[model samples]
Target: MNTPLRRLATITLVMFVALMGSATWVQFFQAESLNTDGRNVRTLYREHGNARGPIVAGGEAIATSVPVDDPFGYQRTYSQGDLYSAVTGFYSIANSRSQLELAENDQLTGRSDQLFFTRIRDLLTGKRPEGAAVETTILPAAQQAARNGLGAQHGAVVALEPATGRILALVSTPGFDPNVLAVHSTSEAAAQYRALDQADGNPLRPNTHQERYAPGSTFKLVTAAAALESGDYQADTPVPSPDQLTLPQTSATIGNFGGGSCGGEQVSLADALRTSCNTAFASLGMTLGEDVLREQSERFGFLDPDLAVPMPVVESVFPSDLDQAVLAQSAIGQRDVQASPLQMAMVASAIANGGRLMTPYLVETVRAADLTIVSQTDPEPYSDAVSSATASALTQMMVGVVDSGTGKAARIAGVQVAGKTGTAQTVEGQPPHAWFTAFAPADAPRVAVAVIVENGGNLGNEATGGAVAAPIARAVIEAVLAS
Candidate 1:
């Protein structure tokens, strides 16, 4: 062969090798990054191309996929629509996601490493690449109870097992049907979501853990726990009713819930918590000091976004200054302190479980359609927030609240439903939102619940958490207990 021809052949081979390297980089290494990019138009197309999985509850497909005629015509169809919107969330090509769909996409879509076993099986079975169906911890009865109990007012209900962190029902009022958002091509339907999102009141929160509110008197549980753990106060510790808590650092005073002082010069901590007395709580907070308060809050899963599920939680905002007044107001659940329904549920659960905070879990297990358990969430004890002794002390005080205090409306016949009530402050002209957190069967708590109602049922500032929120919690607890 001529020298020129040999040299030409060598150069051609080198160029070919470089081209193959570039192609491999783009296809193998860069494909996943490009596909998952937020702006990738082809992402939804690929999601549609895969054999999407079913959303099952009670062995029925509450949600599935069906084919249509648009460019990316296939879509997810929900049988129950609004009934499961907050849980299933909508998977729309036009609008990306919500609920479990947005958070658990990789798992449900079979793109996770955890899906390897199922992926291998599909390959051998000649089945198209598909994800395993998801099973929830929800009971249909519990879910219905949440929706029915809330009625026209906006609120949220979250119930979970005290022994186990399995979430039974999580419902937010004024929920949108997921079916509407699943149909991407229909402009009318998309417009409806926008309207709902921009509604006079926000319908998007689906409260669970996504929204924040002053826990009101419901936060007394934490203060009560802190007070008991401090050793400075026992259940019967004498907390004075000065009518106003004077700030130790600054000349400011914190008043009681309705500006009334505790009738007796000093009341027991048990009596104070049962009455949800603002003055007593402020005094207790001052006595406990700031570090103890902050430690207890952190132990209760404050600042941890994954306190339960992957939902958002407003951490307990501890005052930076240990100002006697700030501590007092915070103890009463006011002046910049906030929490979500989910967070309060954890508090109730910790109290119910003898001071152990179990990480809240929404999914019971991830199983294939054939009932094979592909993955399951082990009931994990997230943190030891307090001691069993503290739990007992708090439980007794909570029971008193339901039996003889502000939470009288939540009383159940023959069943011990320990609870706390909070009538929180709202804007000047607005009635406060009612708040309640509880766990039933004082001796052996099975369910922990947190409920909140917006604008005090439109009752013109007459609303108390016991009157508006506790009843809803009672009904939900009854439903779960019955199950």
Candidate 2:
């Protein structure tokens, strides 16, 4: 062959090999990402045409796809639309998926590896494919109670079964209706989501698991845990209880809430905790230093980069590399310390579960269209935040809070309740956030919960965790116990 012809043939071969390699990479390595892309209209249409499964909670179908006469073939519907919107999250063709809808999409779309047999059977029988049913661990009564308790407040609530890490009830106020996003019209659905997205409170976002807030005095639990774990302090250990504590290197003075003294010049750790004394905890936090506090906080699941209750949980933060004054403030859950209601619920759960933090979970079981269980979530221990002895001491201290302290509003008639209340100041002119966390039947806990009422629950600056959030928590605990 001529030299020019030989060179042309070699170049052509190289081009052919490059084309094949590119095709293989796209077909294999990038296949999953491409298929799951929210903007992929083809995939969206395919999922919409098929019969997606129902998401069942407490024997009720919270989310279901019903038969339709339109090109989509099915329309998604949420029975308790706004009530369960935080957990059941809307499925929309306009925006991407979220919550359970996004987390278990593969199973719901009949494309999960566990559903391989179901897919094969459908293919062989020439029957249209159907997705699996996702059964959640939510308790219907508890969920409803949480919703009713929050009422018109702008905040979030989360309840958990300590032993199993099963989420009992998750709620976020100023909630949006998922049905609006599930409308068959793509243009309409997009418009609805956009309206919610641009709204003032960001109602489309679930504050229970997604948004973070200053934990306030409720985070005193973490400081107490750290002190106890350091082997240097006990519940009755005497700590400073001055009306005001002078922060190091600064003229700033940290005083007890409302400037009330936490008793004598020196107070027992137990009394300080019960009183939610800002000065006492602030002194303790500075003494323990930033390292120990952060360590204990992490043990209770703070600063975790990735956490999922099957759905993603935004990390609770404990700021690192702080000076003495900032650390003192952070000790009381301030100065850049932030947490989600779910994270606070985990903290309470750890204490209730004998210091063993169980990994939080939502979906309990995934069943095929034939009602055969495909997968199940087993109880898993996430971490050990403290010793059994420390937990016992802390429980007693918390019980004291409910009996006579700021947490009195959380007390139940027949049940022994242990809890903490927090009123965290936000900006200079804005109202503080109210917080409450508790576990019931003190000695034998069945439920642990966290409640947050933003902007003082309509009490203006006077709103407090005891006056605003604790009573709501009590109602939820009562509902769970009754059920």
Candidate 3:
């Protein structure tokens, strides 16, 4: 070949190599991002073209895809839409997806690597591809009871199985029906989305795990656990419990609920916890200091952000770099201390499970179109939050709260219930938020639950955690036990 002919051949070969590299990058490396992009019309069509999987709980479908005569062949429909809105968020053509619909999209759309073999088999057999079903850990009875108990309240309830870390029920009130967003008409879905976005409480945001609130006295559980873990206190350990405590380095003072003594000047740690004594915990908080308290909080799954029960959970925050006065206030779950209901439920679950803090999970299993199990979530330990001895002591103390103290409303007939109550003070004008956390049949706890009623529910400033939140937690516990 002539020199010029050889040079032309080399240039052609280089161009051919570049073309192959670009094709590989687009088809392999950029594939996932491209397919997931909301602007990709072809990807949207492909996802909605097939039969998407159902989200099942208690043998009933909470979310399913039904055949529709449209460009997108299926329409996502939710059963008891509002009741389970926190769990099965809407899959919309115009607005895209949220919650479980987005978290488990890979499995539901048959795009998960776990379903790769299934997809190949279907393709080879000339079968129409279908998504994998997600079986949730939700208990229908508990879910219903939670929704009913939180009637007209702006709040959230979360229940967990102590042993398995399975989320039994997660309910967030002021919920929106997902069906409106799942409509075939894009314009209608967009209109519905706009209305829901503007609605009170922002129904689209799930309160159960997505938003955080002042934990109030419910956080006393963590403070108590820190105290016990330090080997410095026991249930009967006597601590200062004055009617009012002058905070160090600040003019503000912390006082008991009724501006009265916490069962006399000095009380047992158990008594202080039972009475939800603000002064006692504030004193203890100052004594333990910020580092110890923050460490204890982290042990129960606070601070660390990457938590997901399949769906992403906004991290519950325990503030850092606190002064003595702020630390005292934080010890009683105020002064920037915030937590989601799910986080508090984990706190109770850890105590009930003998201090083993399990990593909470929602999806129990995933099954292929042929009903073959593709994956099953195993219970995993997130941390050893406290020693078994400490847990035992805390359990007894919590039981006293329900038996004779502020958490009396959570009592169940013939059942030993362990619980704590909280009335977190908000801004000066707004009513305090009510909160309760409990695990029933304390000796052999099956359910650990947290309930929060924002702005005191219907009772206004007069509402207490025992009055508004404890009853809701009790209802959820009873439903779970009965089921």
Candidate with best lDDT: 3
Between candidates 1 and 2, the lDDT winner: 2
Q: Write the per-residue lDDT of candidate 3 for residues 184-216, one digit (tens) a residue.
A: 788999999999999999999999999999999
**Model 2 segments beyond 4 Å from truth?**
none
TM-score of each: 0.90, 0.98, 0.95
1-483: candidate 1 lDDT, tens digit per residue: 699998999999999999999999989999988877646758888888775677766567777877777676467888877666667777776677777776667777888788887788888998877766777877777778888888888888898898988888888876777777777665765686798789865666577677778787888788888878877778887888677767777778777767876667689989998888887887777778778887888788766654537444445455567566667777777777778888888899999999999988877677664568878888999899989999998899999999999899889898998999987886788789899989998887888998988879756488889888998899888888898
Shift of residue 86 alpha carbon in model 2, Å: 1.0
Full-model lDDT for every candidate = 0.80, 0.93, 0.94
C-alpha lDDT of candidate 1 relative to the true structure: 0.80
Pairs of residues clashing in candidate 2:
none
Residue 318's lDDT in candidate 3: 89
Worst 10 residues of 3 by lDDT: 37-46
Count backbone overlaps in model 1: 0
Best by TM-score: 2
- Provide the lDDT at 316 for model 1: 44
**Candidates' RMSD to native:** 3.8, 1.2, 2.5
Candidate 3 Cα errors over 4 Å, as ranges: 1-27
